[model samples]
Target: MSKTPSLARRTKSFQASPTAALDAAAKRLAAEGHTVCNLASGEPDMEPVAAIREAAAKAAMGGYSKYTQVSGTLSLRQAVSRALLRDQGLSYQPDQIVVSAGAKQALFNAFSCLLDPDDEAILPAPYWVSYPEQIKLAGGRPVIVPADAAGGYKLTPEALSQALSPKSRLLVLNSPNNPSGAVYTDSELSALVEVALDHGLTIVSDEVYQQVLYPPARHVSPASLSAAAFSATVLISGVSKTYAMTGWRIGYLASPDPDLIRAAAALQSQTSGNPTAVAQRAAEVAWDLPPEATRHQLAAFTARRRLVLDALAEVTGTELVPPNGAFYGFLSIAGCLRRWREEAADAFCERLLAEDKVAVVPGSAFGAPDAIRFSFAVADDVLKEALVRLTQALRR
Candidate 1:
């Protein structure tokens, strides 16, 4: 081969999102006329609320299709501020918010702005797969603090303290957690926040799954616990999960520190200048339509969660961390994978899909290789079939 210029040094160690990769592979198989039951998707099978869609359509037709402000429209930012206060009591101003293409982008911007080349960020595992990858992409090292079924996959104060080093600059908290569905309690969060403050670390609170939480599992914002935490934490959220508006691509980040918010906005301005104008309008509408408003979708998701719980109960040699919230069931394959324990998790995921045509994400992708994460975000019939297929395949 002729001598060629190289790809960016920044991408030397980057990993593509396994969640997206699995979702896409399932979609490809389905498109190829295969009878695959796709439980790999993290999105609910629902449409954006009618009001949200209508608002976006009206805005687009009213010549509001032009590029928006770099941070996002002031209207959307203000709406976000109001919603945060109304929902979480996270007292943030419109100017302190920066809307991005998605919550993923907001996370990327925050990490990029905060991390130095060799700084360390604490990632409580089995975190969302993107957390570590995003940390790596920001030129920061991800120091994963692994949690297991015993702790419900949540980080304890001791774990947080042990993971800290002088180079630790940030901690990423995702709850109601993806894969694990662990919602951190206010007391738990307060302890973690205290540890973070002592370590002089910033907390990136990803609250995207907050709305999907089921009964008895409360959502607590760390930033709301104390004035210090409020100052130390950056909030990330979007309208995707709550309103089923994933394609809308409207997300925002908020922080009381103007300088940090400004820094992230500066980075976002050069990248995706703004989230879509129509999407921003739609997000504004979505912010007002609480998750309770979608009674049908909520009921369906609750039923799906219960269905998975019941199915897993019959599957011995497996343990599911009682999911307090979110639409995923993170089942430990440790007791079950008697033979596969000697092999890689990816192998089983592939073999299961190839043989049984049931798609689920390998747990290794989430920094927990002894299990798998299944999104219960599908129709009732589809979910039942998928669970049946999973049980049948695992029995082998």
Candidate 2:
């Protein structure tokens, strides 16, 4: 038999996202009737807003199923621009917005459009699982800055200053971050923006969870903080988290720079070629709806956060940090290390799944070892059950 054709080097460089792996494992256990409680997935269990669904139905009935322009429909782009102006206090024209399948694709499009071979991108530790992989896929180097747990898993200006170099093309910032749920304050964001401007680095701010902050905690967008930051910032956001429209597949990128938006749109044309036309129409409504629905969700999430935190509090040696926003509790399980021969985060997660029937994504996947991420987007009873199981597993 002839040797198999060599696969592309790019294919070899890519690794499956850890969130996907943990979700798959949970599904397998549930299929085997283990009564598994999956705290692994990042998606919210709530349904999309009724207005969005109705709009989608109307769009489909009205023959809005055709492919849209590469950058998205003009109306949706206009809606996105208005949203930026209204919410973030940033201004952009329709041409400066490109709607993509999800915030993930929007980010990938930015990397593809901006990165060249050997270019460098900075990611804070405990970042979203996809950032480093995306940088590598774009033929760029990922320079990860480790954020100490002592700092409550937050990145600092000193760390950013040390990581910057001439080749630094972008710095990916996810506030109200996934996995960790650590939201940066206005001052923290401003400080980092100052560092980025000093180094001539483009800032890619992922604000997907901007509206999920708890009481006394406010989200501050880097682009909204200063004109210098806005000039170099590409703000990425979507209705997936805020409006509970994850399956709707509508997300957008807004930039003040027309050239960068155009470059991302060019790649979108050849790749996904705009998001679903109907989804885009529904998202237009989502962006325009009253704030009641989102505010309700945030309140419910905050209550759930309290429940989970209280339950986990009784367990000894488990260091759980209360998230300021986003629906995740990232626990420092380094104390649980003594229970296992191997102290690696992934190994601990595997044991918990096997022993407790509770599934969670390990923090090593986010470049932070000795921790695990517990998503609290499930129902209250489900979250309680998962926490109970986790408590039992950890105590043993």
Candidate 3:
């Protein structure tokens, strides 16, 4: 037999998403008649609003199902343009937008285009799991700067400044952050943007959770800081979170730098091509819907947040920095890990799932080995039961 060819060198940098892995394990157990309470999913449990669904149906029936422009349909791109202006007061023309399969792909395209081999991309700790992986796959090095509970799990300007090197070329920011739900205030972003600008860094701001915010907390786009900041940013967002349309697979990147937009679009064109045709049309309806349309979903998340908060409070030895925007609770389980005689969060999480039947993503997935992340975007009863089971398991 002939020898098998070796996999590409980049394959070494790939790791499957931890949340998806846990979800698969939970589903396998459930199929075997286990009573599993899964809180590992990051997507909303609700369906897209009626208006958005109606548009998809209309598109499918009206034969709007063909492939769109490589970038996106002009109509959808215009909707994205209007949305950016309306929400962030940052203006971007259609040519400056590249709609991709998801914000993940958009981020990947940005990294692929911006990074040369061995370039450094700054990522704050407790970040979304995919950021570092994506950067590495792009032939860039990820420089992780740890942020603690004392800093509200957010990167500070001083830390960012210290992490910079001549090799530094990109900075990734996720507001209403995943796994942490830490939203940066405008002043905070401005201070960070100032640091990034001083170093001539290209800022990739992921704002997918922009509309999933709670009151007294607001989403601020770094690009909205000023013209200089706008020019330095590659803004990534999607209708997935706000519209309960994760499967729709629609996300986009917008930048005032035409060169960056063109490069990302070209990269996307050769990869996934345009996103689904009908999803683009439906996302137009989603993007155009007034803020009032999704208020009910946000209301549900708020109620669930309270439920998770109360439930977690009863779980001894766990600490949570209450989320202000996204529908996740990142719990520090160091105390619980020590009590359970487990040295890592992943090991504790595995036992929690196997023995207790509650699923969560280990904190190690997000560069924080002593913590774990659970989504509260599930049903009220499901969340309640899962928390109860978690508390009981921790006690033992």
Candidate 4:
């Protein structure tokens, strides 16, 4: 028999998403009759708001099954353009937007369009786990600059400047960042954008969690800083987080550069085509929904953040920086590692799952081996139980 063909070389460069893996493990345990508290995935447990659901059902019943423009429907793109102006104070024509399957695909499309062979994309840790992998898949190197827990895990402009090189082509800024939930202030983003401009690096600002902010912690888009910043930025966001519509899978990237947007659109066309038509219809309504539509989710996450921090305080050997936005808490388990004589965060997570039946992603997946990340998007009681179990695991 002929030998099986090897997978593509790019497959060797990155692993599957650790969050999805851990979530699957949690489900497996639950299926086995174990009481598992899944805090691994960042998906919000809330249902999509009434208007969005109504719009989707209306569209489906109306037979909105045909393909949309590869760049998304004109109406949906117009809605995205208006939303950008209203929320981030960024102006973009509908032609400048490319809606994709999700923010994940929009990011992939951007990287594919921006990176040539051996190009470098600067990423901060603990970043969303997919950033580095997506950059690598697009034939670019990920230049990681790690921020310490003392610094609130927010990357400094000095560190960003130091990471620059002749081959550096892109800088990714995820405000209300995942894993760490480090939301950069307006002034902070201005400094970082200045550094990127000085280096002539294009900025890919991921603002998916822009609406998930708590009071006293505002969300600022780097693209909104100035004309130069707007020109340098590819602003990415989606309805998934704010509208609790993760399964609907609608996201977009808006750029002032027509060439870049066109290239990304072409890449998207050859790959995923347009986002789902019914989902785009739903997302159109989602964009138009009042800010009050998601206020409850924000309120819930704020309370859950307090619970997580308080619980962590009681759990020995864990330190947190008090996330200001997003539904995640990235914890430094260095003390636990030392006390348990453990070296790998992944192993600790595995043991925690096997013993305490709580699931969380190891920070090793996000380029921070000394930490772990848990989502607070679960229901209040579920989150409370998870925190209690997490405390028990750490205390033992």
lDDT tens readout by residue for model 3, 28-82: 9999999999999899999998999999999999998777899899999999999
Q: Which runs in model 1 stand beyond 4 Å of their true positions?
A: 1-6
- Model 3 misplacement above 4 A: 1-6
Give per-model CA RMSD.
1.6, 1.6, 1.4, 1.2
Instruction: Give the TM-score of each candidate.
Output: 0.97, 0.96, 0.97, 0.98
lDDT of 2: 0.87
Worst 10 residues of 2 by lDDT: 335-344
Candidate 2 per-residue lDDT, tens place, 1-396, comes to 899899886687779988988899999999998999999988888887788899999999999988888888999988888777787777888988889999999999988878999999999998999999988888889999988678978889999888888899899999988877888888888899998988889999999998888868888898887788889899899989999898888888888888888889888888889799899989999998767857778777989999978988877667887888899989887877756555667877888889888899888898988889988998888898998888888787
lDDT of 1 by residue, 168-213 (tens): 9999999899989999988888899999998899999999988887
Count the clashes in each prediction: 0, 0, 0, 0
Ranking by lDDT: 3, 4, 1, 2
Using TM-score as the measure, what is the rank order of every candidate, best first? 4, 3, 1, 2
Q: Answer with 1 or 4, whichever has the higher lDDT.
A: 4
Candidate 2 regions exceeding 4 Å error are 1-6, 339-341
Reference-based lDDT, residue 31, model 3: 99
